[model samples]
Target: MIGILYFSSTGNSLYIAKKLKENLGGKIFYLPKYSGNGSEFEKIILVTPIYSFGMPKHVYDFLPKLDKSKELIVVQNYGGMVAGADYLMREYCTKNNLNLKSIYVVQMPENFTLSFSVPKFYLKKVLKKADSKILAVVDAIKNEKYNLPKKRKTKEKTYLKNMSNWYKIGKEFKTNENCVKCGKCIGLCPVGNISIVDEKIVFGDKCVACLGCYHRCPNKAIVYKNKKKKNRYINPNINENEIGQDI
Candidate 1:
C-alpha cells in the first residue's frame, strides 16, 4: 500500500495530491492530528509547501512519529527559491531511518503573499505540466524504477522564530458586523485555531498560517493584515465552478 501524506493550506498541494492519486493508486492521509505511528504502507509520498525556507512545524513534528522503513518521495511546492531546504527529505529519512527515494520540486504560483501575479492561461499550462510530471514520478515509484538516495545530516533549527512571527502577525482575524457569527472561520481553520467566543470570532495560536480561514468564511467575516485585499482570492483553486460561483 502507498501512503500519500500531505499538508496543504490554500489547496495547491492538496490539488496536486488528489491529481497524483487519480494518476496513481494510494490511500490519502492528511498530516494533522498525528497520533501513534503512521500506516504500514511500504511507499510514502510526502507533499507540502515550504514555510520560510523550511518545512512547516506541523510536518516536522509529525515526521519523527512516523515509521521510517517506508520508501519516501518528498514533493515541495514553493513560490520563490527554496533556500536551505534542498536536503530536507533525505535528512528527514535519515533521522527516522526511512529509505529516501527521490525529490521533485514543482513551482506553483505563490498563494501566501500573492506578490507575483500569474496569468490565468500561463497558470493553467504550468499546473497541467506539473500534473504530468508528478504522474510520471508516481509511475516510477509504483514500479520501483528508481534508486534510493544516501542519508545525509540536516541542519537543526527549532523553526520557532518564524512560526511565532507568523502566528503573531496572522492572529489578527476579525469578522465584520455582516458576520452572523456563523463560525465559518473557526471551521475553516485546519489546525483548529479559531473559535467563536461570546458571539465573536477568536483566533488561537495553533494557526499553521495556511490562511484558509480568511478565504472560506461565508459572510466574509475574517480579516487579516491588509484586510482590504482579503476577499481578492478567497478561494485560490480557480477552476471553472469557483469562477462561476463567485460571479
Candidate 2:
C-alpha cells in the first residue's frame, strides 16, 4: 500500500499529489493543524513546497510525526524559473532516517500574491503546463523504470546559509477586517498553528510559513508583510467545490 502525505497551501502541490495517487494507488492524507494516521502504507510520498529555499516548518513537524518505515518519495514545487528542491529533501531524509526512493521537484508560480504578482490568466496557463509535467513524473515513478540525473555535488554551507536567512526573515500573516473569521486558515494550517479567537485569526510559532492562509483567504483578507504591492495566485483549476479544503 502507498500513502500520499502532503501540505499544499494553494493547490499546486495538492493537484500533483492527487495525480500521484492515481498512479501509486494509495490512501491520501493531508497535513494541516489536524491530521490522521498513515500506518497502512508501505510507500509514502512527501509533497510540499520549497518555501524560501527551505522546507516549510509544517512539513518538518508533520514528517517527524509520521511512520518512517515506508519508502519515501519527495516532491517539492516552487515558483517557475527557479531551482529544484532535491537537496532540501536529501537533508530532510538524512535527518529523519528515511530511505528516500526518489525525489521530484517542480516549479510552479509563487503562491504569495503580494510577492511576485503573477497575472491570473498567465498563472492559469502555467498551471496547465505544469500539470502535464507532474503527470509524466507520476508515470515514471510508478514504473520504477527510469534513470535520473546524477546528484550534483552541493555546497552545504551555501545551502544552509540560504535556508537560515529565510527562516530568520520569517513571513508574517495578517488578517484584515475583511476576514469573516470563518476559521478557514485555522483548519487549513497543517500544524494547527492558527486559531480563530474572538472573531479573528491568531497565529502561533508553529506556523510553517506555507502562506496557505494568505493566499487561500476567500476575501483576500490575509496579507503577507508589505505584500500590498505583490501579486497573488488563485488556482484556476479549483472552484467552490475544492475551495476551503486545505489548499
- Cα RMSD to native, each candidate? 4.9, 3.6
TM-scores of the candidates in the order shown: 0.79, 0.78
Provide the clash count, candidate 1: 0
lDDT of 2 by residue, 1-247 (tens): 7777777777777777777877777755666533654557787777887765566656756666666676778887887532434665576677777757777777776674556677777776777778888887888787874433355554555545655554322346777668888887777665577886776677766555566667767788877774664555655565523532433
Cα lDDT over the full model 1: 0.64
List the candidate 2 regions with Cα displacement exceeding 4 Å.
33-39, 62-69, 81-84, 146-149, 153-172, 196-200, 226-230, 239-247
lDDT of 1 by residue, 1-247 (tens): 6677877666667766766777777766767643546557767778888777667767777777777666678787876666556465556667777667777667765666533344567656666667667677667766767644344443446344676677764567666666787765665566778777876677887777776666566665666653554322322443412211101
The local distance difference test score of model 2 is 0.66
Cα displacement (angstroms), candidate 2, residue 91, comes to 3.6
Candidate 2, 168: how far from true, in Å? 8.0
